[model samples]
Target chain A: MIKVYKELNNILLVNLNIKEASLENGDAFKAEVIKLFDKYHKSIAINMSAVEYIDSSFLGSIVSVFKHLISFQADVVLVGLSKDITNLFALTRLDKVFKIYNSFDEITNQ
Target chain B: MAQLASKQFLLPNTRQSIKASVQEVLDFVINSLPAGVNTEGISFKIEVIIIELLTNGIKHAGTIETFLDVTINEDNINIDKKDFGNRFHPGNITSLLVYDVGHKELLTKDGLHSMYAVVESDTQIRFVCEEENGDEVLDVSNLMEHFGLLIITKSSDTFTYEYDVDTGLNTFSVIIDLN
Candidate 1:
């Protein structure tokens, strides 16, 4: 299941709990991400600590959400990561794409 | 530094073969790294690099006989792929290395391109176009979109690009710091 919450008008927090962020989940998640972006006036932050695995289509989903938010001058931040996941980011050069922080405090402080 | 065992696999430069090989390669190493991490970022970058490099090897290197080698030990991975289709002019056997040092300073371009998208228990990430390589090969399509290498910049924490026009192959390497 994918959870979306809004905080402080500018913050949108997304929590995903699933083995794979596959097509079914992606469709549902996409709809909500759009909704949250439209309703909020601040940047969005997606909490991915629960996500165990991600694929190409999944990556695209996140990129789309970020692109959507950035067009509105809002940004998304990622916090906490495991090594394998980090390797994927590095391999795809996606490590260069997103704004990732070590902890929740890092994202909040930034 | 966790003792990372280095393993190399070489195969004929084929598109189908390369993609499958890459998936298998990542599965073993990535699984052993950590749990809370998001697979999204790595999957994306791995797809891009594997596709581009394998395609290049099949098309440019013409190494139907020699195998592409990927060496992994911990965060540092060195992919040494040799091809005969070298744009190196002579059509002799050429060698290229795709290296992912897995260090910091991933984005060699500017802005946040070096920051890779990661998914953990608390942190979710969004890969932006602003963080990209100074020299983007995939940029042939969009002002920001890269044909091959650009896709990878968004997948990791560090970036290293080395291509000898003298040799027929190009290697795009990236290093991501997993928190």
Candidate 2:
């Protein structure tokens, strides 16, 4: 469900290869991401370019991971969101809290 | 607006089942629309609405039967969802609650600028989010993750919930304008 693209400057880039991100895999997704964070202790950039739909449960899991990473001074940023998906983030006002980018290279280059 | 298509679905109280049903519902709506009718926006809204409806049902209602009716009209899409679970306590949510990074507080309307619940009547409650058009930012965090009702209300033109005492049915009706 998730593929690790690379680790650059202690920043981890992971890609979610799922069409729908919802309650079905919410817990597992959170666990997997948390495990990665624990092992690498690096800031993570999630590329959600393939996720067409997402629900509050999955969103909650994302928030949970963010809370866990914050204590370690790590953050979770999103990249490559579709228009409607971007609207969803804006709708819930998460765009203000999370650093969202248009592409994976934006984060790696920065 | 005339009814273009209508269908009902009985889904299991599981995320996988409900997720699959939402896809079916979205596909049905897409096939029902006339040629050249742009559905890019409405389709996304409908997907969010249906997922929220069934997931909320399962989360609150437990192992109860759930049914969703999708009716597509000329200018609107109507979704009626029913779950035989516990009754929702809208009155319990009294104040305008807002949460930020490290804390949450209950404030009056003047102090807050985001979504809150309002008890419209004995059997109905309307969620007053930031904007009816759903374009404005909610100015709140999703940390609570209690956004199912708020999301449904903001995504639809009209959103209402009713509990039938005799039938013991909790019904959520939503209408999305197709214009």
Candidate 3:
């Protein structure tokens, strides 16, 4: 299950409430985010703090969604990636492509 | 080299089963490591690689069951994952990730630069492009369906795969250094 919250300044925060993000629920997660975007949420922040790990398929879904949102003039940011998850982004060189933050405060401040 | 600890697990191909198996392997690796060795980074990389490889096996290979064998020694940790599924035929594993890049583009400086970002070392990666008659060609469109192979290659110190067509068994082996 995923939790969605609307923060100040119309920022949408979607908490990925899954332990492991893999092929099983990657598509569903993408679908939910697409729904949010379709509803005119220009800014979305995904909270991956609860997620302990993710496979390449899950990561690919995130990238696909990022591209789709960009076409719509919407933006998505990832927050609270664990040390290992951060390492994965760095290894894949996706850190250069996405806007990532350590915490909600960082995103809100920016 | 001497063997310190070894364990094996057989699990169903379901995502839930894979999750439990990964956790079990991670716990075994953490507990088996010698004292005074930092386990945080190793554990994380092991977990990531395990998830990526197992998930690919389940999803792409159409595997019904999988086996995980882990052996930890003073020098390195060895992981062997076997699945009864379709044979994987990609000559170079890293190509599974960057297969979308055209051959012409791959020859250019920018293409090589982008490839370096994903693969840290050129020596460690291998791309098997064949020459048919006179022209060099690589047919890897079917291989690009999955990107987990790239992650598996990058996360391990050494990686290899073998598919026994007769037995219909696919095995992926990875070694991670302890030092």
Candidate 4:
């Protein structure tokens, strides 16, 4: 469900290659990202362009990752969220907690 | 106003099954809509409602089988779910608050967007969204876990849960008003 696209300037770029992020793959997704974060010890940017929908279980895993990274003073950002997905974040009030970018270029260029 | 479509599905209490069932229901709801209806807004909300309802049964209630009923009306959508699982413990819920995160305040009442939890008895608890209002701050600090119920209540116009002790049945009714 996740692909390690590349690492640029110490920032890990990962792509979530799933149309729906739910309980079925949430645990695996969390473990993969945790492993990547442990190995790199750097900031991570998750590209969620492929995710059309997400359930609470899946969103919980993302929250876990954010809390984990925040504890260490590292950063975790999201990019390429669909309008509905963006609405989901806003609904949960997580839009204030996570740094979300409209596109990959926005993060890469900055 | 008028009934447009109605369907039901019996699914096992597994993550994979729940995920697939949600997709199937979304497809059915979309396909059954009238020709001029735009599903861009309501599709995601329906997916969230079903996923949360089924996930709750599997995770907390240890349910083996979940039955889902989807009824789409002219002005709203109603989802009815049933399963035999452990009774709910409403005492564990510390607080139930629906905040408009964008505006940084609680929403009192809107079209199908009121939220509150009521404990009728030891064997019965209801989460109703009718005409209640609050002015609490938008706090997401301790909302990491056990928020499936919140998501369901927030997404739907009205959500009511009733567990029958006599028959050991848990019934969850959710209604989403369309714009």
* Docking quality tier of model 3: acceptable
Q: After superposition, how far is residue B158 of candidate 4 from its true place, in Å?
A: 0.9
User: Is candidate 3 or 4 superior in TM-score?
Assistant: 4
Off by over 4 Å in 2: A1-3, B34-37, B90-113, B131-142
RMSD of each: 12.6, 6.0, 8.0, 6.4
lDDT against the true structure, per candidate, is 0.52, 0.76, 0.71, 0.75
Q: Report the C-alpha lDDT of model 4 over B76-163, residue by residue, as the tens digit.
A: 8889888888765443543222222122123233222344565544444456444223245433334344457777877887777676
Give the alpha carbon lDDT tens digit for every residue of B16-109 in model 1. 4654666766675566545555566555555555545555455555557444455444545444445445442111213222222332222223
TM-score of 2: 0.80
Docking category of candidate 1: incorrect
**Model 1 stretches astray by more than 4 angstroms:** B1-132, B135-179
The sequence of per-residue lDDT tens digits that candidate 3 reaches over residues B53-152 is 7887776678688888999998999998888787664533433333333222121111101122222232122322221231333221212224576676
Off by over 4 Å in 4: B1-4, B31-38, B90-116, B120-124, B128-143
Which has the better lDDT: candidate 2, or candidate 4? Answer: 2
Clashing pairs in 3: none
Which one wins on lDDT?
A: 2
The sequence of per-residue lDDT tens digits that candidate 2 reaches over residues B1-179 is 68899999887888767768888889998998855667887888888898899888877888556888989888888889888788765435442222232222221221112555544455554555553343555333334545676678778888877777788788888998877
CAPRI grade of model 4: acceptable
Per-prediction TM-score, please?
0.43, 0.80, 0.77, 0.78
Of 3 and 4, which scores higher on DockQ? 4
Models ranked on lDDT: 2, 4, 3, 1
Ordering by DockQ: 2, 4, 3, 1
Q: Give the winner by DockQ.
A: 2
